[model samples]
Target chain A: MTYTITQISIFAENRPGRLAAIAEALESENINILAFSIAEASGFGVIRALVDDPERAFKKLSSLGYVVSTTEVIGIKMHDRPGGLREISRMLGDAGINIEYAYAYTGRPNAVLIIRVDHVDEAINAILSKGGQLIQRTELA
Target chain B: MKYLDPRIEEMPRTEIEALQFKLLKTLVYRLYSFSDFYRSRMKEHNVHPDDIRSLDDIVKLPFMYKKDLRDNYPDGMFIGGQEDLVRYHVSSGTTGKPTVVGYTHRDLENWAISVARGLTSIGLGRRDVLQVSYGYGLFTGGLGLHYGAERMGATVVPASVGNTERQIELIQDLRVTAIACTPSYMLHLSEVAEKMGVSFERDTRLRTAVLGAEPWSEKMRARIEGSTGIKAYDIYGTSELSGPLFTECSEQNGIHIWGDLAYVEVIDPETGERLGPGEKGELVITMLQKEALPMMRYRIGDITSFEDSVCGCGRSHVRISRIQGRVDDMLIIRGINVFPSQIEHALMSVPELGEHFQIVVDRKGALDTMLVRVELKSAQLFSDKLDDLIRLKNKVAHQLRNNLNVAVDVELVSPETLTRFEGKAKRVIDRRVL
Candidate 1:
C-alpha cells in the first residue's frame, strides 16, 4: 500500500523558552500534530512533527523567527519479528551510506523507523536503488 | 630632503597643496588613459581631463559614493588586473553592500605613508612598541596599521583582537608602548583592566592610542584617556579612500587632512553647498594622487566640519572636526530624524549602562515605538535598585526627547545581554512593519 503523510520540522536554538515559542507558532497555525519527536545537539535543536498540514506549520514557524525545514521520510512497514532491523541496516551499510542517527518505534502490526543520514538525496537513491519498498504514513495509519 | 619624505606629517599647507596640484594633474591624465570607470564617470559629469587643473575644480566632478564602488564589485571598478593587485580590504557595510578596496604595490606604499603620517601625528616613532589589537583578514585596520607601524621602524606586536586576559598580559609582560584599535574597544579593555585590578597606567607602558573605524565623541575621548591613562587620537579614513587619510597632531585641535593625497571639502548635506570654516556638513573627498583606482570626487556620508584656524603644531592643512555621525545611519521615526548614535550618546550619559546596546524599532498599533535595549553594568544590578532603574530610564527618555526630538522606550537589561561584536557593532534593529 502507498501512503502520503505530512512531515513537520522546526529548527530552534537549544535555549529555554525556545521550544515553547515553536509550539505556540504551530498552535497558531491551527495544525494538529499527530506524532512528534525532539532531537537536540549542543547549540541547536530540531523538533520533527508529523502534522496534519505541513505547509502551514512551516510558514507559521518561519514567521515566528524559527528556522524550519521539511523532509519526506518513508515509514517502512516491516514485521515486528526480530532481525528485521538488521536487514534494513545491512542493506543501507552495503550501499555505503552512513546513518547519522535513527529513531524507531512500533505501530501495531509493523515497526516504524525514522532514519536520518549524512546525505538525504544519497540515502534516498540507495534505498531506491536497492529495490526496497517505501511505506508512507497513510498506509500505516 | 623634507619634501622627498613620503611621511610628510609635519609639512606646511602651502607646500602640501602645491604637491597636491602637481599630483592631481598627473592623476587626471592617468585616469583618462587607463581607468575606463573614472574616465566615463568624469565625462558623464562634463568634467574634462584638463578642467581639473586646481583643487577647486574638483567640485565640478560627481562625488563617488559607496554605491558606485559596490555597483562594480569584485574587480570591475579596479584599474589593474588581479595579478597586479597585492591585497584587498573590505568595509563593514552599515547601509549597503560592503565595499571591496584593492591595493597594488604602489597603493600599498601610499597606504604605508599615510599610516606613518597618522602614527607620527600622535608622536609615535621608532622607540615605541606598537600593540595592534585590530583584527586581521580582509579588514584594512589590522594590516593597514601593521604595515604603517613597521614602516615607522617601531617594535610591532601584532596582537589581534579577543582574549582580554592575554591582551592585558602582553600589555604588562611585553612592555608595549602604544595600542591601536577602535575607540570603543579601548574602552572595553579599560573596563576589563579595571575589573582585573590591573593598573593600566602603573603596570603597563602604554603612552598613546590611535582609535578609529567608528565616529566617537570628545566626551568618549576624555573617558578613554581617563580610564586607560593614555592620550587618545582619532585616525580617520575609509576603505573606499585609503585608510588613515587624516590624523591629529600634537596640538590635538583637529584632524589634519592629507592635503597632498586627497582634497577635503565640507558641503551642506542637503543643499550640497560648500560650507566655510567651522560649518558641519557631509565630508567630500577628491583623490588628488592615486594611480590604480582614482576616485575624482567622493561623498564620504560622514558629517564633519572644516577649521582653517592655525594650529600650534604649525601644520596649515585643513582640520576636520571629530566625525559627528553618518547620514546613512539616520532613521526617520514619525517624521523625526534619529540616529542610533544619538541614542548611544544619550545612553552613555547614564553612567550605569555599558556601551553595548541595540535600538529596536517596531510598529505598535499603527504607531512606531522605538525601544532602546541597554546592557547595565554589574554595579547597577541590585534587586533593591528598581527605583534607580526607573530613574535611569526616565533620564534617557528625557535626553532623547531634548536631543533627538522623539520619544523612545528604554529597556535596561543585565550586563552582557546585548551581543558584543568583534568589529562594527550591529546597534540598530529595525522591525518597523517593513
Candidate 2:
C-alpha cells in the first residue's frame, strides 16, 4: 500500500508567541494540521506537528522565522488486534532498527501507527522492501 | 550604533563622572514620582532629589536590598504607576518568596535592546539565525533574548528548552547560527549530540553562544568553548535589574556595563561604602532613564567588581567583572560564609562527577547540617575500590571548607539519585525554623 504521506515539523521556542507564530504561518499557508504535541521547559518548548503539504509546510514555517524541519514518520495501518504493535516492533527489532517513540490512534477501518525510529531512512527502506504498506496522514487528517 | 546617551557607552573617564553626576540628579528626581519606598527612605536619610548633585551623593540614598523587593511584594516599590506596567515577571519562588518585578513596554523594549546589543558584541548580525534555548514566560532570559534577536533583524528560533533529539535535528536542518542558553544546558546538549553521532560543532551553523543566569567558573567556560567549538560569551543580568545588564566585547576581559541607562556601583557588602576599582563587593544599580518600574539605588545582591582601565577591545564604558555570588544566597554556616557556587565550582572541576548535584541543608537539634549529594555517571561507582570514593569525598570536603569557609559532608550518590534542575536549581534547603 502507498502510504498517504504528510510532513511533520518539530517546533521549539526561545521566546513567547513562537509556537503561535508557527501555527499562524501554517494556517496562513493553508496547510491543514492533523495532530500536534508540545513539551515545554524553563526557556523553550518542542512542538511536533503532522500537517498537509509537508514540503511546502516546512518551507513556509521556516520562512516565517521558525526552526522547522521535516521527519519521515510512517503512518502504518494495522489490524485492531492485540500484538499488532508487537509484530511491527518485532519486525523492526529483527531488522536492528530501534523505535524511539510511537503515537497511535484508532480509525474506523484500522489502527494508525505514527512510528518514530532510530534510523528513518533504514526503517523506511526496510519496510518498503518487505512490501509493508505505509499509509499517509492525510487520510486520517 | 546610535546610543540614547552616546557619551556613557563610548565615553572617556572625565566625561563618565560628569554623566554620572547629571544622571544621579535625574534618577533621584525621578524616584520621587513613583518609588514611594525610595522616596520615604530618602526622606528618612534627610535627603531630597536636588541634594543628590554628584556621584558621591549616591551614598545619601539608603541602600535598596533584595529583601526590600521581597518585603514590598507585588507593586509597593514601583516608581511608575501600575497603569504604565505592560507585564510583570516574578522570580522563581526558590527563595523565601518570589519578588515580583514589573516591566513597562519601554522596559521590555530596553531589555530587547540590551540583549541585542549583547548579541551584537559577540559578532551576531542580521544574516545569522539565533536559536534561543532559554524558556519563555515570567523568566526574562527567553523573551529578552527573543526581542533582541528580532531587533537585530536576525531570524529567531525560539526553542525554549529540552527534547534534545528535535533540538539537534533543528540545528542541522535550519542551520541556526547562534545559541543562547545556560552553559550547563549547552553542555548537556553537546553530550547528547555526541551520542547521536551528530557532529554539532562541524555540521551545525552555531558560531557563538551566550550563556548565563547561573554562576559558572572560568574553568567551565573553557570546557564549554572547547567542546562546542563556539565562542562562549558571558551575559549578566537579573529580572529585577533587567536582563542582559552587561555584555562582553571581543576582548572578553570584563563585561561592559550600560552606564548611561543604568548606573552601577560596587560597594562593600558589610560597610555599605562604595569600593574602589578592582575591589570585589556587592553590585548596586540605579535606573536613570527608566520611566516604568524605575528603581533608585537598588541593591542587586550580586557580588562583583568594576575596572576603569580601557578594555583591550577598546570599549570605553566601565567594565564589570563576572558575578562572584549572591549575598542573599550566601550561607553562613558555623560562623563562615559559604556560597553554593563555590562548592559547585569545586565539584564541577572534578571530571568524574556530572553537572548535576544538590546541596541539602537539614538541621539536627540546634546545629545545621550541610550535605552535598553528588552523582557519578559510572554504573558501578564506589565499586572494587572504595578509596576513590573516599578520596573524592575528602577532596570535596576540603574544597568546601577551604574555598567556602564552611564544613560540609560529601556523599557520592548513584548515577540517577541526585536531583536534576530544569532552571536555576535550588542549591540549598534551610531546615531551620524560627
Candidate 3:
C-alpha cells in the first residue's frame, strides 16, 4: 500500500563547481545520496535525489542559499528483466496517469524504478493491481 | 516663518489671478514679438497676445508638446541672444533627441528662489547639513538643489550620485540632516546601509528627505520613511520647468506649485479640455518669469491633479497631487492601458515580494504578454517546498490581474538578481521591438 519515496530537489544556477559545492556540503554533513537525477534547462538546474536523512540534508543545503523542495515520488520494484519498465509504464499509462520524470537503480535480484507522475494515488493503485511490488519508505531506509 | 516671498506667496486669490493674467499677456506679447517659432505657432492658431484678456483665456493659446522643444533643438527656443544666456541643461531624452533649455541670469536667480522657497517650506534651514545626492552635470537635479540649499544658508554636502558606502560614511561623519535624491536610490542606499551594519534610525542625523525626478507612489514614500527614519517629501519639477522647483510642505499633503513663478493647469489629456480641481488629468505649466526660454501652456506629460483647498502650512500656492505616471510611460497591452506604477502599487500591497521588479513585455504570435519578474524578500525565503513558491506566484499573478485588469505572468526570481539603480531605475524591458 505504501509506494511513496521522499526526494530532495535543489535549485541551483548552472555554473562551474555549483554541484561540487553542494556535494561538499552534504559530504561534510555525512549525508548519503541513495539516488539522484539532474535536470537542466538554459542556465538553471535542479538536482533531485533520494537521500538518507532528507530533512537534515534539506536544511543543510538550504542554509547555503540553494532553493530546495521535497517531492513524493513512487518507487516500484520491478523484475530484473528487459520488459520490467515497459510493464510498469504500460499499466500506469492505461490508468490515465502521466509520468513527469523517472530515475532508477538496479540491485542483484530486482531493480527500483523511481517515478514522478501527475497522479500519485492512481499510479500506486494501478501498480499494485497489476501485481507489481511497491517499495516502502522503511524498506529503502 | 510662513512665506518665501511674502508679497507673492501670500497674494490673495483675486490678485494672484490678476498677476497671472498680466504676466501671461506680457509673456505672450514678448514671445510673439521675439521668437519666430512662437509667432508662427500663434499665427497658425489665429491667435495673438491680445487674445489673452485674462488668466481664463490661457486655454485659448495653442498647446505646446515635448515635440515642440525637440523640433527647435539647440538654441531655437531662446528668446534672447547668446550673451543673455548663462546656463543650459538638456533633457535625458529616453526616446529621441534631447531637448535643450537655457537660463538667463534672471532665470537662474528665479530658479534659485523657487527652489529655495520649496526648501524653506520643508523646514530646511541654515543649521541643517543638506546632502544633494542627485546626479550632477547636464541633469539639473544636483546643482538645482545645491544652489537652493546654499541660498537657504544650509551647509551643502554636494555628494552627487554613486559611492553609496562613501555617501553613508559622509552622512554619519558630517551628521547630514537633509537629503535630495530619487526614491529608488534612497531604497538602494538603505539596503547598502543595512549590509554595512549602519542603521539610519540610530546611526545618523538624517531627518528629512526630498525625493524627485521620477514618478513614485505614496507607498514608496512610506517605505522610505519607515526604513530610514526620515520624513520623506515629494519634490516636483523637470529640467524644462527649472529642475527641482516645487516641494511638499511640512503638512505633506501635496507639493506647492509656486503660483507667481509658474501658472499651473490640469486638462483631459485626450480632449484637451481643462479639468477642475481634484480631477486627474495631464499637467500643463506656463513659466511666467523666465527671460531666456519661456514655456506657455507647455504640456508636461505627467498625470496629476490639483488640491484646491488651502494647505495646513498656510501657503496659498496651489497644491499638486503626487504624479501618477507619464503619458509616455503608459503601455497598451491587450487593448488595455497599463502603467508600471500600477504594478508597483499592487506588488507593494503584498508583503512577501521585494521592492525590485522588472516588467517584460513580449508579443507571442498575436497576443501581447507581460511578465513581472519580482524578487522575494529575504524574510520570505523560499522553503523546501515548491507549494509555497507556486502559491505565492499564483497569489501575485491574481493580484496583478485584479489591479491591472489584464493577465500578467508572475516570475519569482532569486533575490538580488534584478538590477538596483543608483539613478531613476529603468524597470521596463520591451522585447516586442526585437
Best by DockQ: 3
Task: Kindly list the per-residue Cα lDDT of model 2 for residues B194-245, writing each as its tens digit.
Answer: 8899876778888788877766668878887788788888888877777655
Candidate 1: tens digits of C-alpha lDDT, residues A1-141: 333344666544346776676677778877776567776543444577777677788777655534456666545445577987877778788989776555666764467666666476677667768865555655533
- Alpha carbon deviation, residue B48, candidate 2 (Å): 1.5
DockQ of each: 0.02, 0.01, 0.09
Write down the lDDT of every candidate, Cα atoms only.
0.71, 0.70, 0.82
Q: Kindly give the number of clashing pairs for every candidate.
A: 0, 23, 0
Compute the lDDT of residue B189 as modeled in candidate 1.
80
After superposing the true interface residues, what Cα RMSD does each candidate give? Answer: 17.0, 17.4, 4.6
User: For candidate 3, what is the TM-score?
Assistant: 0.60
lDDT of 3 by residue, A32-63 (tens): 88888887653445688888778888888767
- Best model per TM-score: 1
lDDT of 3 by residue, B307-423 (tens): 867778877889999988677776646433467777888898888777899999886632468999887664234443445556777999998887776699988765565789999
Q: Tell me how much of the true interface, by contacts, candidate 1 captures.
A: 0.00
- The fraction of reference interface contacts (C-alpha pairs within 8 A across chains A and B) present in each candidate is 0.00, 0.00, 0.10
Candidate 1 ranges beyond 4 A from true positions: A1-141, B1-12, B80-84, B91-98, B330-427, B430-434
TM-score of each: 0.61, 0.58, 0.60
Binned by DockQ into CAPRI classes (incorrect, acceptable, medium, high), candidate 3 is: incorrect
Poorly placed runs, candidate 2 (over 4 Å): A1-141, B1-8, B93-96, B330-358, B361-434
